[model samples]
Target: MAVRVLAAGLAGLVAAAGLAACTPAPSGPPVAVLFPGAADDDWGASAEVLRRELADDGYAVEVRFAGDDIPRQLEQLREVLAAQPAAVVIAPVDATAIAAVLTPDAAGEVSVIAYDELILDTDQVDYFATFDHRAAGRLQAQALVDGLGLADDPDAGPFAVELLAGSGDDRGAQDAFAGAMEVLQPYLDAGRLTVPSGRTDLEQAAILRGSPATAADRVAELLAADVPLAGVLSPSDAMSGAVAEVLAAAGVEVVAPGARWSAAPLPPEGEPSATPTPPGATAPPPDATTPPHTDAAPDSAADAAHDRAAPASVVLTGGGSTLDGVRAVRNGAQTATVYEDPRELARAVASMVREVVEGAAPTVTQGATTDNGVRAVPTLLREPQLVATVEEARRVLG
Candidate 1:
C-alpha cells in the first residue's frame, strides 16, 4: 500500500510538471467588448473595428451584443465581470440604468469605458471615447438651415420648422439638441423659424432610438395639421429618411444635405460665415470677388499668391455612414449628414485601452470632462466630418 501511494504521488507530480511546462507566460489578458445593442450600422462598425484593433494590440478580444435589451445587457455585463477581464469597452443601452452593474465595486480593477454615449449618473466609468456630439448636433441643425436657405433670409419668413430629438435615454441626443439650439435659437428668437407643432423642447420632440416607425407616426401627425414645415431638425440619419418620406408624401420640397454646395473655401466652423443672411443680418456672399480690407498677414505677398493658387473645392460633410443617411444624400431627401468616423473612434478606444492598461494617460485632443451623475468623467472627443455628396459618400464610407 505504501509503494502504491508513492507511485500515485509521483504520477501526480509528473502531470503537474507537464502542465506548467506547457503553460506560456501570460503576455496578454482577455478583453471583453460589450455593446448595449447588436453591432448594427455605425455602432456595430465601431465595435468590430475596436475588436480588430485590440487584437492587433495583443489582446484576446470578445464582443457581446445586447440587442437593445436592458436586462440582457446587464446580464452580459455581469457575466463579463465574473470572468474578470483585463478591460472592457461598454456602450450602454441605457446610460443611467447601467450604472448599477458598472460600479467600481462590480468592476474591481477592470477598466470600463463608455463608448459614444455618456454613461450618466455614475462615477464608475473610467473614461469616454466618442465624437463631439454637441458639434454633430450643431452640424445637423446647420445643414437644415442651410438647405432651407434660411441663414440668408430671416424673412425666409416665419417658416415652419419641426425639431426631432434622438431617443430620450441617450445623453448624446440631449447634447445634440443643445448644440443645434445654440445656432438656431437666434433665428427662432427673431421669428425667422417657427415650430408650429409646438414640439420644440428636446424631451417633447424625441423619438425613441430615432426609430423610423416612431418618426413616421409623429411626422404624420404634424402633416395632418397641414402646416407647412420648411425644415425638420432630424436627430439622426436613422430617422431622417422616414421624416423626409413623410414630408415628400405631403408634397414638400426636400433638399438633400449635399443637394447644393458651392466651390468655396471651407469656413472655420459654425455655419458658413459667408451666406445670404436675413435682410437685416449683414453677411458677405461666398463668391465676393473683392477681398476683405482687413490688414493682411505679415507675408501678404506670399499669402496672396498661395491664396490665389489654392483652388476652392466643394467639401462633402456629414456624420455617419448609415445606409439611410447615404441613400438620403444620394436621393436628395436630406442635406448633409455628419460623418463621425467610426475608424477614428475605434482607434481612440484602442489607444485608450493601451493607455489605461499600462497606467498611462490616454491621449485626448480635448481634455473635456462631463459629469455622469456621480463624478466628472474624463473624455476624449474625436473630430467628425461632414459628408456632402454621393461621390464623396462612396469615398468616405468605402
Candidate 2:
C-alpha cells in the first residue's frame, strides 16, 4: 500500500514541477505580519512556511510572535494595522477576540489574510488559506477504519476507542472532530466503537495540567481498562504523540492507514487509484463513494452537529502532529501520521495575500461555508496526505 501511494505522490510532484516553473514573478516585497503563539507549536508549522514563502516572493517580512494571548495579539494587530502594511497575515489565538482589532472599516485598507485558521467574520478579512480541516478529520477516521479493515465485515465487534480532542475553544478542533465523526459515525452507531466517558478531553495539555490529580485519575482508568483500545483520535499530531506514549505503555500496536496528507493534487487527475487486496478479500473500488456528507444547514451545525455510526475492530487516531507523529509511524510505534505539507499551505496563503495586497480576487479554492457567529466563512478545502512510515515521509517530504 505504501509503495503504491508513494508512486502516486511522486508522479504528482513531477507533474507539478512544470506549473511551479510558470508561477508569476513577485509583485512587491512580501507582506509583513504577526502570528499568534510560540514558534515551536505544531500548529505554527504552516505559519512558518508562509513566512518563508513570502520571503521567496521577494517580500520584506516582519513577524511578531504574539504568544497565544488574545489581548496581546489584539494590541499587536492594532499596532500593525496602523502601520498600513501591504497585508497583515495572522493566525489568531482567539478567533473572536481578534474581532475588536479588526472592523469592516479598518479592514478595507490593508489585506488581512488569515492563515491556517479562519478568522471569524470572513467578510472583514480579504481572504483565508487553510487545509480542508473537515476533510482532515475524515482522513484520520478513514485511516483508522482502513488500518483495521472495518469496511470488510459489518458484523465485526466494536473496537475500544479513546478520544482526546483539542481545546473546544478552537473551532478548528471542533471541525476536525466533526470530519472524523463523519467517517466514524457509521461504525460507531453500529456498535463497532466503544467510547469511554472521560476519553473526549483526555489528552488536552492545559486541562490536564490545570487539575493534575483528576486528569491522572481518568487516564489511569483508561490505562487499567482490560479491553484493547482499537485506536484513539487525537486532534493533532502532538496529541497523537502523547496518546502513542500512553498506548505504548499499555502494550498495543497502533496503525494508521489514512493519516494526514496535504490536499495537493496528483501529477494528473484520474491517475489510476491503486489499493491492495488483503488475502481472501474482495477489494473496494478505488473511487468507492467517500463517506456520505449528511448535509445540514450551515447555521444549525453547532446545535445539531452530525455525529457518526459505529465501526468494527478499529483504533482511530486523530491530530496532525506532523514530524513527531511521522517519527512514531517510522518506528512502528504508530500506524501512520497525518502529513500536512506546511510548505504548500504556506505558498497558497502567500499567493492569496499577494492577491489581496494587489487588489485582486484571491486564487484560493472556495468551498463550503462555515459559520462562526460573526458571519459565514468561505473556506479553502485543501486535501490532506496520510504518511505511513519513514519511507512515506521520504516520498512526500522530498
Top candidate, metric TM-score: 1
For candidate 1, the 10 contiguous residues with the lowest summed lDDT are 308-317
lDDT of each: 0.70, 0.61
Which one wins on lDDT?
1
lDDT of model 1 at position 95? 77
- When superposed on Cα atoms, how far off is each prediction in RMSD? 16.1, 17.6
lDDT of 2 by residue, 1-398 (tens): 99999999999998788667776455565466677666787546656777777767667777877886888888888877777778888888777777777986666577777777778754676566677777777777777776656676565555666655555666666677777778877787787776765343324422331232443343445545443445666556655555555554544435544342111123456665332222122433322243434344333322222122112122435446356666666655666656676667777777777677667877857456666566666556567787755687666655
How does residue 250 of candidate 2 score in lDDT? 47
lDDT of candidate model 1 versus the reference: 0.70
TM-score, one value per model: 0.73, 0.69
Q: After superposition, how far is residue 103 of candidate 2 from its true place, in Å?
A: 2.2
